[model samples]
Target chain A: MGGGITLEHFLVLGLILFLLGAYCVLTRRNAIGILLGIELMLNAANINYLAFAFFGGARYDGQIFAIFVIMLAAAEAVIGLAVILAIYQNLRTIDVDATETLSG
Target chain B: MLNSLAAQAIFYVIAALTVGFAALVAFSRNIVYSAFALVGALMGVAGVYILLAADFVAMVQVLLYVGGIVVLTIFAVMLTQGIGDLAVSNRAVGPGAGLAVVALAGAVMLYATLRTPWHLATAVAVASTTYGIGNAFLGVYVLPFEIASLVLLAALVGAVTISRQDTPPPADGAAEKGRS
Candidate 1:
């Protein structure tokens, strides 16, 4: 409120988003839901990177890191979905609880 | 005064959109609904990037996330048949335990964030971050940049190979293809 916004605001927001992702990951039964949670967590980290970069006066570093993070997330999503598809093909279900062939 | 007020207002709006939709994404029972909610959450994150003056990153977020990842998620959801039906239980396991853990983790992060003495510089004129980032990737960070592209290539190949392994048997012919 003093001069508009602060790094703390961004950091707090990122934390909330990160926690939400964690919550989803913990609770969701679907593998794709877990993947979505992971994506959310990555984005939360991106927010922190940009906030620090902007406040620390090293703008490009944070932006570059965010770019890499985004690329990694995309790659992860592709591989994950493919794995999920394969799992469904093999087991005929995408439920993490039900697909326990390796549990023993 | 008015400008700062406007910025603060915008920040609040974006923050709400981000957190609210993210919660929806996390808790929604329908897989398709969850994917769609993720689109809103991701867009809010892009708005946050714009607020941080990372214009290039924001555009990339919109492009890669909104246009690509979200669409791909929805497509995957559509392709998988049982996901839409209630046969797939999307409910969270032990809701109390999960929320408790989230609360604890949120508390720890909030504490660390508030306690840390972050070195903040006076706000300066932010030239386009795109130029600097592009230059660094071409210069100092070139190796990492190339590696990221390689990762993408590998992922592309791997995805196709993995998903294509279960070709419909020729004996079952049309029936198996229709069933799949």
Candidate 2:
């Protein structure tokens, strides 16, 4: 069980995921794109949790935490999209540049 | 050496596809394409989880993110078709190099954290861990779980309310029971 795949492999994957997610969030201006970025970041953390759970030879606390993270991400997306719709209804756009009336 | 060779081959394939698709998602101008690329990246991660032997989590990843979230995003993209079509600023990706730098720094930090010393529990502890997770979810984390469900309920209500007023049911929405 502990012969081939190791914790290090999981950790590196999680790191790459984290970086990709951060780049997505920072660069995208569209509301949904931003939301996807956030989802990616959340999933990166979740991956880490699962990897550690299985490979760090720990109790399933990490897995439990990952499950919670997934649930929370779903809830967040729903709420975020709703908010985006509300904003779009009033302003008719999702560009962060255009919706900066209150950015002060 | 043979085991690592096999693993490396698989990892290289997944890593290339995952990073490439993820970059497309971040760089693509079209919102729908970005969503599609995100789905691709997510599916890749799920595959990695499978390779890591976390079968349950991998399935959940595919089901929740790819099936549920990606589908919902596509529906949203279809709904907002008119909005996304308008010409966006060509310079949306300004200072792309700076953002890349930040991402690189974050990547390094995360790698360092992962490499830092962490205690590893014994296999006996790992053996009952799955059951422990279940009991912990119910026993210790129940309150948060219940609260999260309520939040989801609220989101459902909010989604209905938002998508209702501006656009009435046009058969696309299919909210017609007796309205037609």
* Residue range A1-104, candidate 1, lDDT tens digits: 36768899999999999999998888877888888899899999999999999888888888999999999999999999999988888888778887878978
Model 2 residue A99 distance off true place after TM-score fit, in angstroms: 1.2
In angstroms, how far off is A27's CA in candidate 2?
1.7
Best by DockQ: 1
Tell me model 1's lDDT, rounded to 2 decimals.
0.87
Candidate 1 Cα errors over 4 Å, as ranges: A1-3, B1-3, B85-93, B167-180
Tens digit per residue, CA lDDT, model 2, B61-115: 8898898888877766665545453342224554466476766787687668766
TM-score for all predictions? 0.93, 0.79
Q: After the best TM-score superposition of candidate 1, give how far the Cα of residue B27 lies from its true spot, in angstroms.
A: 1.2
lDDT (C-alpha, whole model) for all candidates: 0.87, 0.70
Looking at model 2 chain B, report the run of 10 residues with the lowest lDDT sum. B121-130
